[model samples]
Each structure stands twice: as C-alpha cells, then as structure tokens.
Target chain A: MPSIKQIARNEAASSRFVSGHSLCRGCGIPVVVRTVLNSIEAPVVVINATGCLEVATTRYPHTTWQVPWLHIAFENAAAAASGVETAYKALVKRGRLPDEPIVFVVFGGDGGTYDIGLQALSGALERGHRFLYVCYDNEAYMNTGIQRSSATPFAANTTTSPAGKQSFGKLQKRKDLTAIVVAHHIPYAAQASISHWQDLSDKVVAATRLASPSFINVLSTCPLGWGLEPNQTVRFARLATETRYWPLYEVIEGHYRITEQPLDPSLPIRAWLEDQVRFKHLFQHEDAEVLARIQREVDRDWNNLKRRSEADAQWFARHSERLAKEWTGSAARPAPAMTSRTNTNP
Target chain B: MPLKAPKIAPSARMRLLTGAEAAAHAMRQINPDVVSVYPITPQTPIIQTFAKFVADGETDTEIINVESEHSAMSAAVGAAQAGARTMTATASQGLALMIEIVYIAASMRLPIVMAVGNRALSGPINIHCDHADSMLARDSGMVQILTENAQEAYDLMVMAPRLAEHPEVMLPVLVSQDGFTITHSAEPVSLLPDEEVRRFVGDYRIPYPLLAGEVVTQGPFAMPDYYFEIKAQQVRAMRAAAQVFDELSEAYQACSGRRYQAVEGYRLDDADRALILMGSSAGTAKEVVDELRAKGEKVGLAQVRLFRPFPAAALREMLTGVGAVAVLDRALSFGGTAPLFAEVAAGLFGQTVSLSSQVYGLGGRELFPEQIAAVFHDLESTEGLEQPRFIGLRG
Candidate 1:
C-alpha cells in the first residue's frame, strides 16, 4: 500500500483526474475527488452522478478528467458503472479487449447518493459489482443552491428548510445512509472527513482494490452553501470529527472498526457549528434546546458506534485470523465465476 | 481464451419456437458481448431462456441480472457506449419504467438492441397481448420494428444489431412482438446458420469508445451552440437506418429465400381499398383480405414492418393508386386519435385518398376476422374519414 503522500507524488507524475476545474476554491468536494482518484494505481473509468463535483468538473468541452469518463444522468452512476464493469468482463472474455485489471469508480454528491441515487446505489451494492462508490456528503443539494438533502444534519439551515422567524432550522433528523449501506453487507463501508487525508486516502485504496463492492462517505465541505470562510473549511472539517458529529470508522465484512477515537471528549459541538452561517441563527438566539438536541444526537450516535466497535474488538481478537483473511486479499473469498476467459498475455 | 464459435447450420431450417425462444435463439447466434436484463411478465422468458444458454456454456456472453428495467437500460447504455454489443428485454410496465433510458440510449448514439414483448400498460393492469408497450416507444427516437410471427421476430432480432451499429446509423433499436398473442404462441420459424448470422451482423465497432485507451467523454451536456447539431445526428442516423435496414433485409432475403420489405404490402399492389396496421394483427387482417379477395372484392392489406423512421416514402408509394384506406391500431393515444392512425394520417396528409382509423384490441382485446372485415367494409362505405372510431367498443 502506498502512503497518501506517495499517491500524490505518483499522480503529479501522471494524474488520472487532472487539476484546474471549476469547483469552489475552498470546497472540499474537489479534495475528496482528487484524494479518492489518486489512490487507485490501475487504469480507471469514472461515472459521475450530477452534482457540484460533476457540474463543476466537466462543463462540456472543458473536462478535468484525463481518462475515460461518463455522466449519463443524476441518479444512475452506480448502475452505469455496473454496465462498464460488465462490458470489461465481456470484451476481455471474448478476447476482443486486452485483459487489463481496470478499476471502476463513481463519484456522487450527497444529493445524488443519499437522496436521488439511493436506489441505484442499493441495487449496485446488492448485486456486488467490483467498484468504488464515493459520496461527497456536503449535507445539502449545493449544486442546486443549498437545498436540504437527506444527508443534511439536524438543525442545519438550508434553502428549502430555512432557519427563520417561527422555524428552528430543519425539524427532522439526518438519515444515517452509511448504516443503511452497511446493511447491504458489502465488503467495506467507511466514513471519513476531508480534514483527515490519511484516513480518507486509506479507505479509497482499500475500496478500489476490494473484489466486491465498496462505499465510502466523505464529509466534504461546501463553503458557499455552509456560509463559512474559504480558509476555515478544513478547520471545520477537523472540528466535526473531533466533536464526534462525523465519526471516523469503517465496517469490513460485518466487523466494526473505529479508526479514529478522539482522546478528548470535551470538544464542544458548538466549535464545529459556530463558524458556519447556516447555523448562525442557533448562536444568535439563546436556543439551548436546539443546541442540546444537536449535541445529544451527535453523542448518541457516537456512543452507539463505540458499543459496536468495542464488541467487534473482542470478537475479532478471538477470530483475528479469520478477520485478517477476509481483508488481506480476495484469495479466500468466494467470488462468483465472472468469466471463462483467462488472460492470454499472462 | 478464445471462444469457439457455435457450429453453423449451413442452410435455413424450420423449427418450432415461441417468439421469446426465437429471440433468445437469435441472441445465441449473434453472441452479443454483453446483455443486461431484468424479468417482467411476458418478457421474462426471453431473458431466462437466454440465461440458460449462458449457464450451459452455449455462448460466452456476459448476462447481467439487473434489478429493474431502468437499470437494465442504464447498464446497456453504459455497455454499448463502452463499445460492447449489448442487448436487453422488457415489456409493458417494464418498458414504461425504462422509456426514459430508451430515449437517452438513442440520443447518446449507443447501438443497443432491446427486445420488447408488447403488452398493455397499466390501469387495471391486465397483461396478455397488445401494442400499447411498443406504442409508448414509437417517439423515443429508437428504430422500432414489429414482427408478424416467430420468424419475423427471429429475423428482426438478427438484423437489429446490423441496423443499429452501422457507422452511418448509430442508434438503439427496439424489436417487438405482441405479448402472449405472439410471445407465448409457438410457430415454425426458420433460423439461419449461426456462423452466417454472425458474419451478417459483423463485429460492433464505435469510433469514440469509452474504453480502448483513447480518452473520450460520453453523454455530454450539449449547449445551444451544438445541441441542435448533436440532435441532428439522430435524424441522420434514422434516415441512414431507413436505407440500411432495406439493404440488410434484401441481403437477409437472399440468405433465407424470404424477401422482407419495410412495408409489406400483402395483396395491396393493385387493390382499390386497403387496411393498414402492424404486429400479429396484420395476419388477422390478411386472413380477412384473403376472404374478401376470393369474393372478387378489391380489398388489400398493408403491414408496417418498420414502424419507427415511419417509412413515409414507401408508405406514400404503397398507398398510391388506392381509393380508400382504413388504419387499425391496438394502442389508443387517449384524448386524441389512436397512435397508428395519427402517424398514417401524417404519412398521407395531403393525399386525395379517403382515410379512416379505429382503435382495436386495447389491453389485449382480441380482434376476430369479422371485426377486421367490418373495418374494410367501413372504408368502402364511408366517404371522407375524419375522426377515429373505436371498433368492438363496449357501449
């Protein structure tokens, strides 16, 4: 496995996703995109669902992609990727295509993945296609102008669910799509923030190499939508994980592994929310109830994840070899016989 | 490992097969590189039987078991755009769900062939036989063809790839047959030799494939500067298909000894009156025409084999010298005239011949010889046909 720094260096030599697109300067989506794409070593084909990442990257004739890229519709990236992977298998099997181990990756924003694209994502996961589905979760429909998405956190003010006069921001709680994705029982499901480059980079590496389907939800930042200073984006990203609002953990083959357990438990959630104007109303008024509820939801989610992680630790200690075997390589895994054709070149 | 192509039959031989079976057999011979499919009633056999072939090692095609018709076409768009000869099957509600991607497939210029078991769309949800499913797809920019029997279904399936993947005509194609009426009904259909069918279709090649080392973008968002030019490609492709299909049909005729025309004018060459429609119902109309012809009546029948691309030129030429024509449709446009009637009216807008239309066999309503003969009679007795009338409709 290459280090995150090594991945960047190799990409600088020959990058698959070239730089200089139209994503916002402080936006975390491009960071997430570059990191995830840079981690993969082999040739890749990218399928994107419509969002800020997609619309900003390729605005017709001016594409940021150096490899084969496709954007069909807003909600079928995973479904389309399934077709591309299937095409690779068929062509290679028929000896019309050279047998090369190319990887398939899809990038979708929170609106695309957590909302409109959930069905296609679920279907692709259930079918167990060999690909990586990365969701740059910036909490709302940023490309469509900051409308509330299912991934938007509780009490986060959005255009659709505003925080004005009588309303106290969004009334409903955020959906835990990562948990729903883990329910599919795929090989890997992880949650990482853009502030944590190493964790995000490592997850991307593991996801791209896995023989089965893998999903990683990166908590990207949208400065314009979140109403934060461009330079303060990464700072808020780190504060989010520190406050346990965005826990860094991964589930591998049903085992919960907490990758980042903050040593200090006193990082107030306000530190993460105060800088963003989307949450400014919560600070302007003495809304302790809303603040307390946000903290309660964050702590409750973190505790539940911890309970699963602690229990998983003991179980893994007893069966570490079995767990390691599941991850070391796909050799022991029971993969479907995808094709009868073998590499003639090999 | 190179797959040994299936042994050729040398000459066309007749064998009993269902519409679904014939389609699968054609797929087996074509040996497409990829097939993404999901099962729906009336259309399931095409995919399931094809799956059996893949399982039994009769062919090396990769069959993707998708979750829904939408994904099936979505995957097909991906596969075909990536330079694989891809195909799938759907019908009725499945076709409705996939109709969006069907249009996208054509607009993107992905030459995917989809086999549709024509069934009625929802509302009371009865599914037996109708042209409603195929009707919904007529305006989707795909080259649509309907089969009269198992042989036409088999032959069209074999020809779909050739028409769609032609460099001059890169568009998706839909081959349809009525639901249970033709899909489940068995008939003696002749098939060409496997190698011969393969040689006719040739290998699918796209100039700008998503794979093959050359970096290319597909399904790009065209702005005003180039949107019209990009859309004109479909127009150009459709026109090219109108000619390609004709030439391919002639070539197929030489091989099978059965010449097929885009518009099969059965007994209509010198007739004074005609009944025009498509699908298996054409056969029913032909039976009536035969009886009417034996009685010294100057009635004939014209079946639309190539529905999409309309074949207006051939239709105008076929309808020439005829005094009156009655157009029958199995699918109603609702709040308007029946779909086929509208197209036929548009096809012969300025012609002097009197034209009439009637909606028949909706939601799998059967059309008997008497009802069809009534339509021919209505054409003869009536003068200056205006609005469409519903035949055999409940009062």
Candidate 2:
C-alpha cells in the first residue's frame, strides 16, 4: 500500500490546472481548490458560487482556469451544479457523453454556502445529485470587504457587525454548516482546514467516491479580510484547529467521527481569537467574562462532538469496511454498458 | 446526396397571444436547459407556462421555482455559467429589487436572458406600462431590447438568448414588453417553428472559459488593478452584440419570411416630421403616423428595437433629412431629460434636425393614438417645446 505522502505526490504530479492566474498571495481558497482538483482523476466540471473565489479567479477575456470552470451567481452554485450534473448523467445514460464517471463539484464561499446559497444547497443535497460541494469557509463575506456572514464567528469584528462601546462584534455563534449538511442525511460530510493539506486532499478524494451528495466545509484563511499578515494564514488555521476553535471531523451515514482530536488540555480559545483583528476588541476591553463564555461554549461543543465520535466508532468501522468493499468491487467491474443513442445533430 | 434543410410554414396564422403567452411560446421554441423562475405578474404567466411544460415533460428542461427574483437571477447566472442555456422573467418592483445583482450578472458576463414586463417605478405605488423599471437598469451592461408588440416581444425573446450567448457578446439580454399594453394585451403573433429557430440560432457555443471540463476562472474579485479592464471588456462585448443582433435578425427573417429591423421605420421615406418611441408606445405612434399621412400630412414614425447598444448610428441615419422629430418617452428621468429621448437626442447631436422630447404615460397612464397624434400636431404648430410636457397629467 502507498503511504499518504506517496499518494499526495502522485496527485500533485498530475495536477490539471497550471499554477498562477492571479489569486492573492497566500489565499487559502486556491490552495484548497488545487488540492481538491488534484485528488480526483475524473473529468471535473466546477460551478463556482459568487464570493471571494469567483471574484479572485475569473476576470473576463483572461482567466487562470485550466479546466472547465463556471462562475455562476452567488447563492445558486449548488442548484446550478445540480443542473450540470443532472445533464451530464442523463447524457451519459443516453450515450451522449463518454461512459466514464465524471466529477461535478460546486465551490462556494461561506456567504454563498451558509447564508444566501443555503436553500439551493439544501435542495440539491436533498435531491441526491452525485456531486461534491466544497464550502471554503473564511468566516465572513471576504470578497465584499469583511462583511458579516452567518458563518462569521461570535464576538468578531466585521464591517456590518462591528464591535463598539455598546456591543461586541458579532453576537451570534458561527453557523453549523456541517450539521446542516448532515441533517440532509447525505452519504458523506466532512470538516477540513487548509492547513492540513493531506487531510483535505484525502477528504475530497473520499467525497468524490460517494454515490450520494457529499459536502466538505473547508476552513480557509483570508489575511486581508481577517486583518492578518499574509504569512500567518496557515499558522492561524492550524491554531484554530489545535485550540478546538474549529474542530476537524466527518459525518458518514448519520454517524459522527472525529478526524483529528484536539490534544488533552487543548490550547485556550483566547489564543486562537487574539491572533486576528476581529477579536482584538474583546482583548482590549478586558472582557474576561465574554472570553470565558466563548471558551465554555467551545468546550461544550468539543465535548459533545467527542462523545458522539466515541459512540459512533462501531458504525464508522462498519462504514469504512463497506466503502472499501464498494471501491474494490467498482474497480473490478467493467465500465457500464455504453448507450447507443447519438448526440450528434443530423 | 446532401439532406435538404428542413422546411416549415412560411408564416403560421397569427393569433392574438398575451405578452406573457408570447414570451412562453418563445421559451418553448428555444427549449432552454433551465428556467429559474419566481413568478411576479405581469411576468408570472410566462414562468407558469414554462413550469407546466417542464412538469408535463414536453421540454427536457429543468424548472426551478426559487424564492425571489434575486434567487431567480442567481440561479440563472449559476446555470448559465455551468454551460446551460438559462432564462428568467420579472417586472417593475421585482426588477428594481434585483437591481444590484443584475449589475453583477452583467459584469460576470453569464449570458443570462431575462424578460422584464415594463412597469412603473414606485412612489405612490402603481403597476402599469412605463419604462422606469428597465431604465433604472440602463448601465448594467445588459443588451436591453424593447418590443413594441406581441410579435416583436416573441421574436426578441427568441433572438435575445442567441445574441446574449454569442462568443463576442457574452452579456445578459433584457427583453422588455410594456406591463399592460403588451404583457396583458392580446395581439396576433407568429410563433416560429422550433426546428427553424434551432437552425437559425444554432447550439449555444460558449467561447473559451465557461464550457464544462475547462477550468476557467470567472467573476473574480477585481481590485483596483483589474476592475477597469474587466469593465472595459464588458463594454466591448456589449458593442460587439450590435453586429450579432443584425446577423441574428437577418437569419431569423430568412427562416420565418418575416423581418424585424433594429429600428423599424414607418412612412419616414418622404416625411418632414417624425415621432420616435419605444416599447408598446411605438404601436400607437405608428397608428398616429398613418392617420397623419392619410390627412395629407408628411409625418412618420421610428421605433427603437435594440436599446442597449443604443443603435445610435442606425437612429442617426434613419432620422436624417427628416426636418423635425418628436421623441415620446413613456418613462421619466427625474431631474433630467427622458431616458430614451436623452439617448436619441445624444445620437442626433450635430445633425440638422429639430428635436423635442415629451414624457407621457407615466405610472401606466394610457397613451392613446389620439394623444400621440396631438403631440405631433403640437410639434407641427410650435417652433420648439421648451420643456417635456406630460400629456395625461392630472392637476
């Protein structure tokens, strides 16, 4: 069996898109996108939701995309991709497209996936399209200049939800998109961070293999949007996971499994919060009680997730075996019989 | 042996179909891949018909009933970007509500086609024929096409997506039909055969970036470094749509044996005075022009078909040698001149023509043929109408 490093190296070597068409320096979105793209070998069509990713990559007449990329309106990437995927499947069934498994993925920012695009995403997931949706969660509406999104962390400074004398930045906690996706009872759902490149790539690869809808909520970093130095993107992302501020986990067939357990006596949530300008006001105000409340909330959520993971161990083990069997069986089987229908216009 | 091109009726018997029905017929002929629709009259019937078609499995198209006009356009942009021919319809307040995202759709160049039931912008709240809703979207980089009657409304709807998705013209198209005048008014319209339309328009071939399996970046964040150039590209695409419009219209005429010009002229060949108008008001003005000609008066009419590229050169050529032109505008510009009239006057600048503009039919007040005829008579008698006069204003 190949090691994880060997697997990553092979995937990287076969990267479909060329490097550098103009993303901001150290942007985590492109990194996650590239890793995801490299992990899959199928013919991939990407539907990009309106947000930082769409705004950063495509400028008309000149683009950095090396594969079929579409920039649809914000809030409908899932619906749009469902159309594409549906068309592709229908065409394949009719022998219009080649009899090969194709990958249809929708890439959305936090605002597009968790806020405005949520309804469409929910519909697509419920409809059960064989597609993967990747939500690059940078926590705020970063493309529109650090505006507050539903995924924006509690007590964090954003343009619309600013922390002032009367208030702390955002009063609400970050939306649980993973829970939302899992609620749809999709075959697979995972939470990942850009800092863990290998883990992210593995999750994407696993997601594409599922027969039902799969979602990967990636914790992406935005230096400019978050008011941090460019070089600290990866470091901040790592700290987030380490402190259990952004836990890494996966849900499969209604079962939760912790992919990366935070070490005993996890780092204080304050350490992760103080790293960015968004939480600076909380530190300056000496709001110990607010900080304590945030810490307690994180601790409670982490403990709950940990307990669920422990309870679902047997289910996940069985799921892993079934997945392995399916993968091996698919590999052994010949390609599905090609349909005789001709797509060519007479 | 080469297979002969499929033949259909030269012109089917014209039937009076509502503007909504006309739009529905056009959508049925095109058979787009997806129609992301949220119903708002006088635009609801169009989507309703489309939804019925999808449900009946008459057309192999996806019908998504979204939450709002915002979501409708959003879904359209998404579907179109995913390389599917997609469209939606909205009107008046709905259009105004979607103003911001509409601009984004244009800048993104998603090739989305929308039908706007031209209605009044709100203040005291009214829903009737006026160009204010669409006029507010003038700078959104969409190829705005105004239809004068049910026939033009139907023809333009079929022609719009083709022009919008052209490689050189990958911008959205707005097919505006007056809210009540055309949208609700039933008029005889020739529905083109689906095969003929498919032959004329051909399959939508999105150029470089948007096709499936091609990783092309779209709608990227354009900072100070790239925003201006991206805008310039959008402008270039809109300008390029002019030639495509002409090409498509000619092909459409060849296929259906009926023709539509970018600017339709009625009795303007040997006339000294003419009336310029857009949308359904053109139908009224044309009637007025014919009546004046029968009365031994030399008056004609020019109707604007394509509004986005403005058809400035075409208007200038059509209006040349005509001694005077009165532009009847159905929408107000507020604090400035009438929107369509302002564009016309700007086009005719430096040309030897006595020009005047009048704002009428504000908030869906009817502009009858007699009212237009009265305006023409006023223009004939007066040297220059100093300011735009409202014909149907109540004191």
Q: Write down the lDDT of every candidate, Cα atoms only.
A: 0.84, 0.78
Candidate 2 lDDT, tens digit per residue, A6-83? 546755676555565566787888878877877676677777887767665665556666667766577778866765
lDDT by residue for model 1 (A1-346), tens: 4565787796897787777888888999878877877777677888888888777777676788888898888888888988988898888888878977777889999889988889889999999888889999999999889999998888889999999899878889989999999999997899988888877776776676577889999999899989988998888888888889998888877888777766467888998888899999998986999999898888888999989988888765666566444453322223221111121111
lDDT of 2 at B361: 85
Error of 2 at B240 (Å): 4.4
Candidate 1 TM-score, true structure as reference: 0.94
Which of the CAPRI classes, incorrect, acceptable, medium or high, describes model 2?
A: acceptable
Q: Pick the candidate with the highest lDDT.
A: 1
lDDT of 2 by residue, B1-395 (tens): 12221122335556668988898888887887777777776787788877787678767676766666766676677666656677889998889867776888788787888988888877878877788888888999988999977888888888888898888988999998988778887766778777877676667656543444445665555567878988999989988998999998888788667677878888989888888888877766766777778889999989988889889999888888898888888888779998888899899989988778888888888777777888888767556575678887879
Off by over 4 Å in 1: A315-346, B1-12
Candidate 1 docking band? medium
DockQ of each: 0.58, 0.28
